[model samples]
Target: MFILADDMGFGDFGVFNGGQSSTPQLDDLSGISRLYSQHTSASPVCAPARAALLTGRYPQRTGVIDTLEARGTDRLALDEFTIADAFSRAGAVTGLVGKWHCGAIGEPYHPLKRGFDEFIGFRGGWQDYWDWTLERNRTPVQADGRYLTDVLGDEAVGFIRRHKHERFFLHVSFNAPHFPYQAPEELIGQHRRTGRTERVAVIYAMIAVMDRAIGRIRQAISDAGLDDDTLIVVTSDNGPELGGDGEESADRWNVGLRGAKQHVFEGGIRLPLVLSQPGVVAAGEDDTFIHLTDWYPSLLTHAGVTPVGSKVLDGRDISGSFTGGTVDDVPRCWQWSRYHPMPTSNAAIRDGRWKLVHPAAAGTLGLTDRDEWIDHDIKRHPENYAQPIDEESPGWPAVGTEPMLFDLAADPEEAHDLAAVHPDVRARLATALHAWYEDVELDRARLVST
Candidate 1:
């Protein structure tokens, strides 16, 4: 099985959602695959999302509720079992190429120490596309004059060539379409005519490069005749940071899904996910609402691996959705909190078509227990707050009030808040969210105190 994580934007792919940017490769490939119309990472940031993907558990469950950054040396614990470790245990030669934001500059957090036998990537959240600071098992590579996306593709193809004979799990986590979005002259000139500049230009160029690299990876898989043997998975970490570092307007992107990147709205959490395994799983769209935690059990079931959780917490084995099956019965939930006033982008939950969002209610005595996690953590483990949390930092929005709800199927843009219209859904979902968090806190408190 192989995973290709594309840091794509909302309007990036043409197969699932119609778009102006021509992505023929993704379009053609998606048609022969199953698409997740409503998929979300445990958290909207890179490190947290990656943590959830690797552990097959919620990021919060493993203290990865926020993006992993170099500050305070925060990282996934060395003893933690990662998806790559699971694959390795299953006898699959695993490797990770591209961004490794969970943690860097530490042996414990490095992919090599985290169950990946061959690691080719970097530890930073982002780097320049043309001039990158990458690594092969912590050995820095002079990307010299090559574009990052292209370099990653080269490494991926080489890895496949080196390990194609066995069951291998290659995680090609592309950092393109993220930031410092520099591109080749031709692509830039094309977008220049369209008046794309600054962040937009960078985003377009990065996506274009990423798309081309995807073609290379796809071609390599087909050439090795492993297309049928491999389980190809693709998705983005989070939504686009519209105005850059998330301080600007969403402009024409995010497709009116409401909010971007850090919020719990559709645009922030909902993502495009596709999984195809040919004879094992069929093609087409599965309008299922599942979270990153689902991949753990789902992949485990498919590969004959063991469970990551003791009592089947959070996510379910969503692989059934690949064959016209569904995860519609599972109520999708989201909860977020910020340290300050930041456009009311926090706390949300979706039960069926109804989505309830609590926007920055941290100041009120009526603050939900969900928001209390931060307050308690700050007080209980003040040392944990040692990391710098400026706007540019990874784990952000240090503080936030208000709650909103929407029927996403009817209001995908989250234009109208129907919290008043459907108080029962809000109350019940909120209660469930509160109960779940309370349980998590209890377990964490027990572990920490002991």
Candidate 2:
């Protein structure tokens, strides 16, 4: 069981939030689970992070460099081998319940065609929480008055029950606290009564609802007698979405980590990871630097299934590391921008305790008018936007030419810059980051060209 939350920060967990948000269920689960304190999402944004998570490769290599589906930037290349493909090849029933932002166009990019035998979710980055139009294996299902989060949770429980007798790999993805921040009035009132601003209240309420749903899913798993057999992994796709500056902003407690979603800072990519399996994986905290991509090979190896492709994978099988085994200390890199990727913009590389970042170019930080239109088109008329369309380049001016360096071991919040103090380290990491950009961009170019 792989459970994901959208736009949930480390502070959103009740165990870390100092009780600002309600996540009692997750707090309880944390007691018996192995908490990875230094885990990170592969990307700062949703589509690319998901791409890396599913394919065990960098997002650029998978042709999912950005999140605009109408412009086709979010589509995962068909040639990629997904974790689902690996699990399904091992004869497990694979199901995806919730947001499927990796692709949102034609049937070719659908989850049903991407190794998932069962898919019940939306295929877009954002959706209307109240008037959601979901699909169960390509068949549209209109909202039936239930909250969207509850609906997805119910579907996950049903999947578990139906496949209790068989080997299954279920991905329960919850789009909580992402957008369309709507929650039951009761939940909102509880947070609002605590003096939280309206936006923060709504966001917390949404997360509270999701927390309840997650608890229910866990109960269902236990009821089905899969507690000992199932390996449950809980994590988020990326950091919380901080709204525009104001008291009404969506910002809440984020453990004092710098930056928010769409940034390359620790707060953007750093996330909470919990793995639980009774008597198999011990309960404790592991501060190893684990990336989202690691789950692909790790989980497959844990299930005693060989990876299903000859394609090279960027992730290492760290299943052994869960139980006092050594983890490879390797550098992880991330880059993102609107529309086409800008290698020099919003890019970061972490090699051991040192991190080098090229802050986003100011002009490239937002979506263009056409990008906004494309997003709207995909949400409203997905059929009409099934194919990619040419987009005019923003041609934004570049900034932040000088890279910023931080020693995360001493400054996990990335508050201090060590670039001038450690020029040699900065130069070395910068060269490596540029080389990585060139390599991944070459693969992306080949994929798009063909």
lDDT of 1 by residue, 1-450 (tens): 445454465567755445545567777778888877777877656776787788776665565544425342236655467878878878989889888777644456668888899988776567767656677876767768888888998899898888878888888898867765578877765554244444565566567677787788888889899978888888888776665343132244555677776667677777777788788787877777788878877887887877542433566788777777645567655554432113234666667777777664444212335433443343233345445333342233434445677888888988998878878877887787666666655644553464
lDDT of each: 0.67, 0.89
- 190-266, model 2: which lDDT tens digit per residue? 88845467899889899998989999999999999989999999999999888655556887779988999999898
- Residue 377 CA error for candidate 2 (Å)? 3.7
Candidate 1 residue runs with Cα over 4 Å from true position: 2-7, 16-19, 195-198, 244-250, 308-312, 337-345, 360-400, 443-450
Output the worst ten-in-a-row residue range by lDDT, candidate 2.
392-401
Q: Please give the TM-score that candidate 1 achieves against the real structure.
A: 0.85
Using lDDT, give the best candidate's number: 2
Q: What lDDT, from 0 to 1, does candidate 2 have? A: 0.89
